[model samples]
Target: MEETDHPQYCGIGIRGVAIGIDSFVWIALLFVAIFITAAFTGQLETGSPGLNAELSGAPASMALGLWFVLALGYHTVFEWRFGKTIGKALVNIRVTSEDGSSLTFTSSLIRNAMRFVDWLPALYLIGIVGIAVSGQRKRLGDRVAGTAVVGS
Candidate 1:
């Protein structure tokens, strides 16, 4: 195949940095949700209760559910529609099919779902190792989904 037929695979370092950026964004949103929920429910009173206690309440449960949905949606929608999340776009990398075609929703869902496994043993140690060992720099999710992260 011609060089153009195969996009450049993104290495673990850049991918890690991109994920770090995304994680920061997610955390910020989570905090905002928590504060908003707390404010509405009068849980923000000084010294009324611990932050953890407040977070374990109904509003926090809603926020947690929202976070879960948002996290899955973030990856699925972005990868399926644009082939990149905000962080991936900023980093100039994207998820694509092994054949370099546009990514599909099913593939995106599969990869994102497999993230549970990738996150094994904390901090994605398994994912990092998978990326390192795979010739195409594919993480477990990528391998399972038949996709790859590539420079755009």
Candidate 2:
């Protein structure tokens, strides 16, 4: 019998657990962002009067912006450096191009940044649909970048 040339990917399209883990990380980061926003917004009522309401909006925006950066930027940089996110590492998976090579920085950046389109209008429903239908278990970003997540 001849062996397959391609690597075996996670059957359920990156697996529920991997997505769950990544979602957990994002949720924690979002919570922190909300807390920081609340703290500066004087909504905390913790008696920190020095925190100005006028300044609150900027910090909140900054935190929110950082959250986006952490999601996309960190993934691009760290995955380029290590071929895996903390979540992917925990799940023993790595992302690579379909041709079997580490993802390029340009591809990673384009893919992650383009998540805005994938997430447009609502609950990432488009991205989820894309992932489910893709043979490579890739979401919109993955498809745009020509990449796949596979077992390590």
Tell me the number of clashing residue pairs for each predicted model.
Answer: 0, 0
Q: List TM-score per model, in order.
A: 0.81, 0.72
lDDT per residue (tens digit) for residues 26-145 in model 2: 887776666666675666544456433233467768778867877787678867888787778888887787776889999888777867887766766777777778776677888888
Candidate 2, superposed: residue stretches over 4 Å from native: 1-4, 11-14, 31-56
Judging by lDDT against the true structure, name the best candidate: 1
Pairs in steric clash, model 1: none
Off by over 4 Å in 1: 32-53, 57-62
Model 1 poorest 10 in a row by lDDT: 44-53
